[model samples]
Target: MDRLKALAFTTSLLALVYFFTQTKFTLSSIQWPTSLFGGKQQPDFSMYKSLSTLSVQEFPLDPAQSRRTVIIGDIHGMNNSLSSLLDVLDYHPGSDVLIHVGDIIAKGPHEGSMTVLSYMASHNITGIRGNHDQKVIEWRGWLDWLHRFPDGRKWLTALERRWDEAAAGGADPGVWASKQMKRHRSPWWRTIPKDWKIFTEHYKIARAMSDAEYRYLLSLPLVLHIPHAHTFVVHAGLLSSDPRYKPRDPRQPLARVPTVFGSAKSKHGSDVPKLRRAQELALLSDIEQNTDPWVKLNMRGVLKNHDVTRGKDGRPWSDIWNRDMSRCGGFEHDLSFDDAHTTPNKHKMLPCHPSTVVYGHAASRGLDIKRWTVGLDAGCVYGRKLSGLVLGRHKHNDLKKHQSPTPTDIPFGDNFTGHVVDTECQLE
Candidate 1:
């Protein structure tokens, strides 16, 4: 009888404690996380119920002479490619118009290249936002996307410990990290001499930008209709491929396309592979009907297989929670304008708008230097090669300014495209 009575008393006391504590806890607690979005590098997409169709679109059409307009593809972060391309085009700054296809960030030799390239764009270049550039914007929460990394956890704790001190002291963690990386400065980051390190480390991304500038970059239309050549210029090509584009709504913000559920509009989103996937599928009928003995397989052969490759490692990392583990995680889209399997004949490119399309998201290995996009994106950051395409009256093999080879090329470690181009060095 005594034990039972004690037990009942304790239970009653606990109930009273819970009832009384509820209000106090509610009143005293800190703010609930209303901003569900993640940090600059990651964000939460669940906040938006549906994705807005508002992906990028094309700029106004250009009307002029019968001359051709050069369109380049993804640059990633390789400013060297851009430089060499300009040199090739002999771009007269104001006279010639160059269209950068997309992807202004990620992968390449230096972060600073973006800064330099941005400066160049303000002066002469115009561009489209590639999947990587979109990723950069989306990663920063410009567009709604699912969150993976926990909030404010982009940096390791060690760096976080020194963040406030660095920020308060007007020190940058990335610079400090690079300084501390003194000894470990991988062969890649140290290719350029130390004298130029400060300006060069982030030279590409550090050239001061204005709101008008970034907005200008963002404002650039994905498609550039050239009435001059009767051609349409685009970054990764339209997903629908029919040219029947639906404009994204202006009022509401757009949402991220979930990797698993697929997109209601199309399986592919803004990513390069998705755009290509749609094209491959659309072209299948043409490939299948190739009755000619010379023609190879049609679009089916190219579109049938899914691109398993993505991310820096060239592996799929789109949505881990969604895609099946068994699916091949290494599907890579072809970089060159033309591929062998597509046409069913010799290696040939799609019938590009004869006027011109220039792009460079892809990198390639070189025999001598870090050849920018041998096939495409020739390991630039790894000190391989910086790549770009110069479209100055594209008259075939003649347009390319051929230069003889030197040492810098190899399969292994050191022998990289150590060749440097100093654009920012100001002379007294």
Candidate 2:
């Protein structure tokens, strides 16, 4: 009986040692209270996975404070352009607030993304998620999901090599993935290498991202509101149809709208052939009128090729945005929170002050500056100037004296007060 007892103790000690070695946790480093029985606690990734699509952030500057607030559009890995633009603006890091519209990476110099992320972190900048940024999150999320299994890192590295090799020969990774998915339809996830080829060139950048940088990217909200500046910043554009449209799942990125809008790839997702030309025109009219986003339920009403009406240079989503959400009863109707201090949720239907919107992601039109809506993406990756919008602070007494204008009374045309700042692109 004593011999058996000794053997059981020895086995338990060996198992504990193996666990410690596997997890890299030791008795000296472990927190006594939380590490009950000396076990390593796994991080809870639920919050990150379920992050909100819309986040309301306030930067209420004291009326007495004097500072500049600037919003920059799609960097697209243009570090030199960003640096030059800041120089042109005479950016004062300590006294200024910087906000970045998305697409901070992709389709440009690979080195720029890391530089941009590092700069934003150091400067304490706020940002929204661009489509490219969403692509990064999806890719990163997929890789992370794979890492839960054994030999995942090895598989990911090997898969990266495969993607690089395919791209070297002028092959489209997404097409390749589509073919693979089609061929193995029963269990798609198993066949997929957990690598998305659309962002093949960005894999290294994605992999090299530090934990904090990854968190920063993942934490980016889809929409930003600055009441003081009367500005709302978004990656692409907001929907006027559902002024109060909250996503069915806040966990999903807010910029994703299922329609024939956006890049060419997104154009092919739905069946638009069924709708007649007149029907298509009516849907466009409905969209313009800020009616329901979907004319019919189950995504069948709108014509898929309706975007062609906007011509080669697509119609700006802002052009169709008929109302200023901040002023209209709309902002109040849409927000989920009940109070000014509380964040919105699904259950809450609260009123919010409307604000002007400044957005990027539409580069074909380039530097579209309307009275209420501004598109700052000047296609920096395509050798266009990177743009910034500068809003100077209003003095305390001036702010008090400033009367808020009614929605219809808001000034338009040349009288719009914001300034557009730009810097020449430096492409290699």
Candidate 3:
């Protein structure tokens, strides 16, 4: 019995050594789920939420100061179009403040996207977190882990240089070598190096990215509040039930701690595979069946229910936000946009006060402009036009004084426009 025990231990140790030798790295070298959206990495929803909500910024240094806030819609890496739009608006750098409605990267050329970000950073442009932007940020974390070690950095730098040379049509067929990966059929997956396929396709872009650029994306806020304009800007719509609604930090996680009910009762079956599938579906149904009006789904939820929840329809949160201003957690009276000297009420007590929200996550419906909300994702990366909402200083004052007693009927504050992009591009 003692001899048998020693043999088992030896066998286990040999197997472990063989595994590491075959993989060309130790188990510690493998950053599990290093790919975007958890390729092989374990999903830690809490860590994801914390990293995602790490940044939130307020608009207007002083509400009383003269300001012209220009809020642009999703620019899915269309730098040329963004430049054209800014020129059209004749953007005044010092006096006019620029804000994006999220989705700052993905879809366009990698280099172009970097340029756009550099421009925004230099110009002090800020935005809320869009789904695409969120995905990229998540990808950034994995890339950071991959490149953290010296050996990893050396491997990545060599790979990135090869890719860049191949992309430029150099004699070396660096990009050609990755063709074997096409059998997998994921464009993202194919971009990863052969030995390093454990990581994400975003590695190519991430390796090329400067540290400052990554930091800029890390600093994105989930929501921006404009006190003078009485507006809240987010990449997606707001859920009043969320604790973050009141403070609205972009760097904070938006999802609540999922309440776990007792496991659903299941009938025992001889077919183990069938039983497992049934269990998965049952768990999914429980999450989907949650009746809360403000339960916001993260990327994982959407991907899981992409097929299951199809064809079902419900009213958008903005459309149903017609309750009294006080009930909606809004001010009793309109704040003066013209007065930069005016301060917000410190002792004001109120329930959920609904304000106008400007967002851009819904691209399928295109630009959805309503009385209380503005959806600006025009699917530009899908070959549609890149849109922008210009909120002039004069319009700010005009809307502030003209607040309708009926909150639902409040006028849309910004002037919307789109720049046409003829070529169709894939959505990230």
Best lDDT among the predictions, by candidate number: 2
Q: In model 1, how large is the Cα lDDT of residue 374?
A: 16
In model 2, the Cα lDDT at residue 206 comes to 66
Looking at model 1, residue 332 earns an lDDT score of 30
TM-score for each predicted model, relative to the true structure: 0.40, 0.57, 0.53
Q: What is the lDDT of residue 421 in candidate 2?
A: 64
Candidate 3 accuracy as TM-score: 0.53
lDDT score, candidate 2, position 192: 32
lDDT of 3 by residue, 292-363 (tens): 212221121122222212112444544533222223322222222223245354223231223466777677
lDDT of 2 by residue, 1-428 (tens): 99999999999999999998867755445323222343554333222221122222234333245676668988988898888777666677777667888888878877888888777766557777776776676666656655664444555566557667777898786786566456645331352333446346565666777777777877786666543344556666654433233322322122122233333322122332211222222222334322221111011111233332223344445654433232333222333333435544423322222235677877777887765678788888899878877665532222212321111122322233445667678784
- Please give the RMSD to the true structure for each candidate, in Å: 16.5, 16.4, 16.3
Backbone clash pairs in model 1 (N, Cα, C under 3 Å; residues 3+ apart or in different chains), count:
51
RMSD of candidate 1 to true structure, Å: 16.5
How many clashes does each candidate structure show, in the order listed? Answer: 51, 6, 19
- Top candidate on TM-score is 2
